[model samples]
Target: MPTVIALTRFGPPEVLRPLRIETPRPGPGQALVRIRAAGVNPVDCKLRRGDFAGTDPAGFPQRLGNEFAGTVVALGPDVPADGAVAVGADVVGSATAQAYAEVLVVDTAGLVVKPPPVPWEMAAGLPAAGQTAHTALSQLGVGPGDVLLIHAAAGGVGTIATQLACELGARVIGTAGEHNHDYLRSLGATPTTYGPGLLDRVRALAPDGVDVVLDLVGGEAVTTSLALVQDRHRIGTTVDRRAVEEHGVLRVGGRSLPALREIVGKAATGRLTLPVRTFPLREAVAAHRLVESGHVRGKVVLTV
Candidate 1:
């Protein structure tokens, strides 16, 4: 039996409770993984609490994990040829539902291998947020000589996206709370204070205007993003789902993606870096509360 973590109800982080059940066996094209580390994401909490209005919740006593870095312990029949992932390959992706457990069931398509170099926690936490940043930049056509603005620059996606934009030859200015200014600078971004005259701070850096924006914080940030860039095509948001449905903020490519393969490749090859804070799987409730604090400097993970 698997001791999976689930929320019997939706409320505070305390709702996340451990429950024991039969270990799942992968079907024809699946594999069973012993989760070494599971990534903690805001979307995980939002969906867990039914606070995310963009889609339906996964069902009560819902298992709560999207990505993890783990070893393949068992393989189902007809698994991918090459069997590229052997019994002990270190890998990451979104397949850890009730993943904050001893073991998990996974689909290969949701998997990305972590070469011997990356640590388990970093590998576990990078996939989703890194991919979201990658897709946002890719879709906006951010490149050399571009000027980009990234909202919530201290958060998981913002930190990764800032570095990526800088690597693309784009002059990146990031909006984060004043406390995180130095942190953003370390990622090669010009930190712009996010409230009260946000554009003034940006204008001080860009002079002309930004060429693209990746909004991780929604609400007013969506309007602020549009106001900074003339072309609406240049702005997109991952958190602002309402903006996508009503106000016209474009949906980023990776949101609808089953998994991010090539972008994860970037992290695997050292083209990207993941910043993470980790908690043990038994501390799942505390992990959710910490991330929800809105003061996290980077990604968080639950260690199995």
Candidate 2:
């Protein structure tokens, strides 16, 4: 039996409850994992409050959490034989819904092995934010000599995106709150404070123009991003799918296309480094509240 957290209803963090239940046997093309840590994101908070409207309504008493790091312990029929899917080793990626549990049953394709020096918490934090960073940067053609702007630079996706863009030799101007300026700088992002004149600050940094803007803060930033960047192909939105679509902003967030394996591989080998603020699984509600409160510098992970 395994214990996991489930949200009873769409409400504040208090609605998240824990329960002890039996570990599920892997179904076809599935693998069972003894979860070490679970990544918490702003999306989890939005889903808890029913803020975003997109996915087909999941059955009630829904399990939350997406990215997680764990070890393979059991195999479902779907896993290929001949030891291609290694068991009893460190693994990381997304799950269908059971990530909050001590054990997770996920698609074999979703799982990837973690190389040495990649901490479990960092691995847990990678799947969602890492993929978003990778896809958004790739889609925007972020590269050397490019001046780019990234919104929410202190956030999970922003932090890694800043690093990746820096590694790729792009001049990254990142907008976070005043408090996070130093941290953003540490990650190799030219820090700008968001709110009350983002464009001006960005222009001051770039002088001539910006090649791309990854707008994590949707709404007005999307419009501002397009205006700031020379090419529309370089602007992307990770948080708001609808607003981006309505305004025709580029979208790099998940749209049923799973990129966890690729994301995990990058993070595991150090091409991507994610920060994890860790908490115990029993504190799932507090973790959700932490995300909802919106002061997080990076991803939050729940340890089981």
Q: Tens-digit lDDT track for model 1 on 1-304?
A: 7677888777788888888888788777787888899888888888777785345655577888877889988788878646766567677777645567778877776677777777888888777787788788889999999988888988888888888889889988888888898888888988888877887778888888788888888888888887788777788888777888876768784642333566566767887677788898889988999998998988899987
Off by over 4 Å in 2: 52-55, 77-84, 255-271
| Model 2, residue 151: C-alpha shift (Å) | 0.3
lDDT of 2 at 273: 66
Off by over 4 Å in 1: 52-58, 80-82, 253-261
Span of 10 residues, lowest total lDDT, candidate 1 = 253-262
Q: Write the per-residue lDDT of candidate 2 for residues 231-302, one digit (tens) a residue.
A: 666788887777566767688755123456665656667676667788999999888878877788888999
RMSD of each candidate relative to the true structure: 2.2, 2.3
Cα deviation in Å at residue 31, candidate 1? 0.6
TM-score of each predicted structure versus truth: 0.92, 0.92
Global lDDT of each candidate: 0.80, 0.80
